[model samples]
Target chain A: MRPDTPKVLFGIAGQLIMQIMPEVRTPIAGQTLTLSAALLSMVAQEFDRAASRLVEENRSVRTLLAASRDTVSEQALRSRIDAETADMHEHDFHVSALQAVNDRLRSLLIDVHAAVETTPGEAAAGLNERIWDELKESTRRRHLASGLA
Target chain B: MEPELAKYLTSKIPGSTGMAISNVFRIPGGASRETWMFDAAWEENGESRSEAFILRKDPPASLLASQRELEYAFYRAFEDSGVPVPRMRWIENGSEALGAPFFIMERILGCDSNTTRIQDAEYAPVRDAIARRMYEIMAEIHDFDWKGTAIEEVLAPPAPGECWKRELDHWEQVINENELSPQPIARAAIRWLRANPPPPPDRVTVVHADYRVGNFLYTVKGIHGVVDWEMAHLGDPLEDLAWSFMEAWEWTRDGRKGGIIWAEDAIRIYEEASGTKVNREALHWWDVFGSVKGQAIWLTGARSFQDGKTAELMMPFTSYWLINFQDEIMLRAMGRGA
Candidate 1:
């Protein structure tokens, strides 16, 4: 154990109680505390995974954006998509870079989603399923620890 | 309120009364109104009187919420209609009276607000019957008309298919504007929602957008009242049923829908009471929609906490407690989570 471990635990209890006790001790406080501790623990997990999750999402989005160039009929969106695909830099990927790409990809997702809604076919269906696939993965990535039962 | 303000309110309660405001606590956001509970007493007309009264003030933030007067008027209009709501005695909208704004109502007595009670041993035996009764009340509410009534002018117009669209756009817009991190789950849910629009509702009815466990007041015998009408709106009534039946609210984390009844049984009970058929597919749509809506609200609360908009209980509580489960709800809606 670290030399300051006792102090750290003491600090945690002191800080949490000092900050949250007034509101925490209201209706169903125990439930609130248990849930809060679980969430804080999960946030710690998500903290470890955040950059990776964003990196993966950004990569997935880039792949979809590239694929969209073949089928998305809107010339402007297609040209933009191709340009984004051509500028791919997987080297030295950071959380901020992933976040930037994630934003662009999400914007593209909205367009792609709307586009597929208008045009109907097996191809569109496949793309829709791909979007859903990403969505499911994203949810899995974002899952947090919570009190059950 | 300041002690002076509390004393002033004590003065306005009709007769000369000296009462103490014991543990006058402020809960989290009322969203639609400022809700505070305090003890009040005085000579009512002539004789001695004492009782707990809750003050619901209309804050500057809640301007476009469900009309305060109208919300009160609904129950007042339906006083004999059997939907159990607190007797809303007075609604004061003008801010001049009490710094912000407020309403007063008789506080319903002796009820616990724990969200876990439905499955608790004390209440388990009666949960089924209470569940049925709650659904029955909701069905009756769905059957009631808000148009040919007193406060029709106050609520937003009930659009046909645009109801879902309007609500979705607003909530999605909120997520877009305030989200601290990427919200891919809500984003996916929105796409799915618009892509597969549910059948146009049978008719728009009063929707209690936040109908779930922990929001309602109940006894071991049955539900006495369903509280927290902050998100009440004019929309498909089935939205309430679906929101109530959402699996995340299964406090036991089992198949028990709201720790009250099974999903099928909930629908059956509501249908039996309202004489309306349950559209399974549409209800399924609303169930998914409920998760999205739930996430949006929880996210908003988290944003409030992060932004320091209000250090209120609910904001942090939701940010901590409900946000993760919201993702789980998303996974379930996407056919991923259990």
Candidate 2:
């Protein structure tokens, strides 16, 4: 909290890559060191955005599930979506809780997307587009700041 | 460890009065197996005999869980073929020998497979040649006749039309079994892949399921030996080509497939060598499928790590590095790039 988590991690990763890695004599040990540094870099990136990404994705998936209910003809799927969408607010803002809710919503979203693809109509088409849109947005939410892709 | 391995080698190597294994060291970057390099010296017929050997021992859990026998057959099938592979010596499935099943091969010395070094300006003069030969060897791999070979013993070839479904279903099951969290993007891509399947391959060929730049050993002259046959199978040749073109292997992130040649150049070379036309639509389908397969591999490693099955740091490292990035690649392949 003093120097900030990301900054501290970046500092340690820089040391690992630049200083400690060169001193590692064994091939496997050095490779592990390099990967450790890389892991630090990725963890640093996630540390700043983990909670926000989880919350954003949970909300986005829940919204899609709610909209998909009317378009899907599957009775069980619609009821499940309705039940999941009923609680829009995050009573527990903890990342774990949000992720738990996120998993349920996204799982239901998959079911919704599958069900809607079977029916053909204006409403189903609209729901399909919405599902794709949310899927696209979901990638953006998880995109790393690192130039990996 | 060397003493134990040398003792094990004594039983495997015949007519050797004495044996000594020295300089035993673990080679890095073998995520699917624990690879080691050492020099084995022995007295055969009262004469000094030495060989540099590579040991590919199975880990408790790996990014892949391929059968060692199947992998051995694949490496054996390509020996003396156009494709260069290390000469496989022996394969032991019994774990009692070295704490796990392993196979030893004659190491192809004085070559590097480091991806970053191959992409550097120092190797610029040979990069084009290497890239060209890469595709040429791929063509050879696809052209190899496996009908009466060791390959047939390990793998059953899928029908042309069923290739996509088999691979898609396999990776989808992998994702289903290993994912710790829901993957909406992957799920959507999987749906699209199901909707638009590719045409049957012209012929089923040997698919080096992880064929790419880093998998092959090279000098500035050219590639020497292609390694890592853990995922080798009989399937669509296009799957291997598309996998080589995956964005993740674009180590430089400069749009070059395998950080060497452009996609068009790779395709042209492969087409010319293999005498087959690469359908763009089909390649696109495999490209997306490649991402799904890639993510499944990483997720498998991640789950292995999280479940306390193994403590290999590379597991979480790859998951952190590739999982989300692979999702973005899937989106792009699905024409939903954001």
Candidate 3:
């Protein structure tokens, strides 16, 4: 099959579906087709960015973790951040590895979040604000056009 | 004999020849009972007559302590009291034919239960007023004295400070058993709840645990009735009030309390009609607790769907649709990292 054959076939099938189940006569069927189309659209988007988004986000979190070395007072956490900072970014980093890192960072982010919530001082406040901004921005990058960002 | 049901219905409804029941269908409303909506016919006096009614059968998953008979009694107590409740016709506890205890009642007449479309302009113009009326009626329910009704007889007497504990423990146990996801937010809220417990209830009253905009029937005139009394029990009345106003049911996203009426307006109407003041802090406490309870439900739905325990429409939809929203609610409620 040609590279674009799947797209052409999906479009043809979708048109047939809509013609047989117009919204006025069959709203549920029509809605189902529309949702299927949307799901396929998401599949296409994900196909293009599946790895890139993970790579970008993993790098961002690693960057933030390194940046935290100056702010975190706990020697253990600081040393972990320092080691993670020294780690080289690898192209061979698989999707699962990136996601695994993401999960660790996210869980650690919660700890960082809870710690900052209890702590005071401008450094803690500023660090907390930066973490919030990163979380917000990360959500923005992942926002679906169909949803509220 | 679905013998208990046949005997119970026959004795109460005086009839004659051809008074035989068949094709009994016990539908699932298992949290409350095995609800059977079926047909009955008989010769009353001399004429042949028929009617469609509901049967409530007690099951193992009694979410609360209230008996099926008490629900029937409450329904009977309020049949013609302008409460828009179903006409509860019969109650049968002896299990013989159906294999479980059950009751029969006149099924409510309305569209399928849904609040998702209540906000559409087709239903919206009357939606606000209907919501207001529903809140007012709920206040009337909150004020309905257990002392004067059969509710107190079936429900346990309230303790001085155990209402919150009872509710929290029940819902938390459900989550512990049924949760499909790691609920960091609910876990944190449970901790906060235990640490800063709400004060003892001003009054213990019957709580409809699943009260919300969706579990009701409304028309252009106003709310016709509040249905689905499956999770009814005794608790702090404010728990009912807060559950009704929980934020997850905010289908309209216009600050409409439970997608029905505005929070302030609903509370005002409730207070005016019930003659009972709602404490803002306690209600807020119940509101967060309501979110936790809702998470438990969504969690249960996911577990049931996965375990093939129920084939209901909502089981998968709860996990696919509302689990994330429940997390979002937990985030907002706890005022953590949002």
Candidate 4:
């Protein structure tokens, strides 16, 4: 823990890739070992930012969904969005919990986006654009800083 | 496994006795099939005969669930054609043959299919030539006549105007069936795809659905063989072109299409060779569709890994690395990357 978890993971990944992978007898086994190393490197990256990214993205989507309520014409969708927005506060900081909350909110965001797009109004158009923007931002939030890709 | 393969080969080859398989090894990168390479030696008419062969056996589950017979037909149809493909020898549908249905082909030797090596300085001299021939061979594939060939026996040609809908519908269903979590971005992309469909091609041709930089065997001299026909289908030819241009295949990650040529250059070469016009609108539509299809593939592998159907590390590795990256690709293709 002194060198941090990510550093330790990368260290193990480096050993697997540079040392163990070469010693593997079969080609497929070697390739698997190499991929295992690369996976570790990427997993380390995800471990570093998984929680923060999920929490940030959940908040972002909930904000967009709440704002989309007025822009959507579907009453049912608006009510669902309101309920989802109200439930955005992630009581559990675990990555899995945050991701569950994120999934719920993002699924609602999709419905809100679909509703807003079909509704012909300036407000609907603006909300649609915001949804696209949030979607793009979400991709950035989940980006992993690893050379494996 | 080796003994069974050798036993099967003994019956397939004429005048062969004492058939034995050696150096049997798995070849990585075949996500859908359990691909293996081995050397088979037998006594043929009082002489020793040894040859290298590649076997592709279907796995229990995979990134793509295409019929092996269809893939075999495509390979067989293209034998001795302008498109360089390894000669397909035998296709057995009986799962009892090798625990699953499989086909055998002559192994292409002394060529590298590694996507990472093409950009290395060792291949710098022939990179452009490889890129040119890559598209040129693709043109040959598009131009091949499949009317009475084995290809027609397996895959029915889609209506020219229906290629877009057919492919989009297929991949959307794959995503719907396989996705563990809600794919909001992919779902939105699918909606947009339906809203704006591309025009059909003049003729439906053999679309090498997974044709890309890494999928082919190449050397500093040129490409030796185009492999991976599991996803091959009869569709709009531009679909292959656009799929090749998917950002995921751009190993350089610098917007170079396939990491060998720019989009304009690749199009120019392909157009001149295939005698087909590159419709920008249709190509753009296919590019976005390609991302959706790519995401579907990664999702399928993810599900396969999660379901304990496979212990292949490549499954989860692909899911972790490409799933979100594919989302970003779709966003960029849809003009929302900024």
For residues B21-131, write the lDDT of model 4, one tens digit per residue: 998999988989999999999999999999999999888888888888889988999998988999989999998879888899999999999788899999998889999
Q: Compared with the true structure, what per-residue lDDT tens digits does model 3 show for residues B141-176?
A: 766666766666666766849999998998999888
Q: How well is candidate 2 docked (DockQ)?
A: 0.71
Tell me the lDDT of model 1 at B135.
86
Q: In candidate 1, which residue ranges exceed 4 Å CA deviation?
A: A1-39, A90-98, A117-123, A147-149, B2-5, B27-34, B44-46, B57-70, B96-99, B156-166, B169-188, B316-324, B334-338
User: How does candidate 4 fare on TM-score?
Assistant: 0.96
TM-score for each model: 0.83, 0.96, 0.69, 0.96
Output the worst ten-in-a-row residue range by lDDT, candidate 2 chain B. B9-18
Candidate 2 reference-contact recovery:
0.82
Candidate 4: share of reference interface contacts reproduced: 0.65
Model 1, residue pairs in steric clash: B57-B102
Comparison by TM-score, 1 against 2, better one: 2
TM-score winner, 2 or 3 = 2
Better of 3 and 4 by DockQ: 4
- Candidate 1 local distance difference test against the native: 0.70
Model 2, A38-116: lDDT tens digits are 8888889888898888888878778777777778887888789878888887888787887888888888888888888
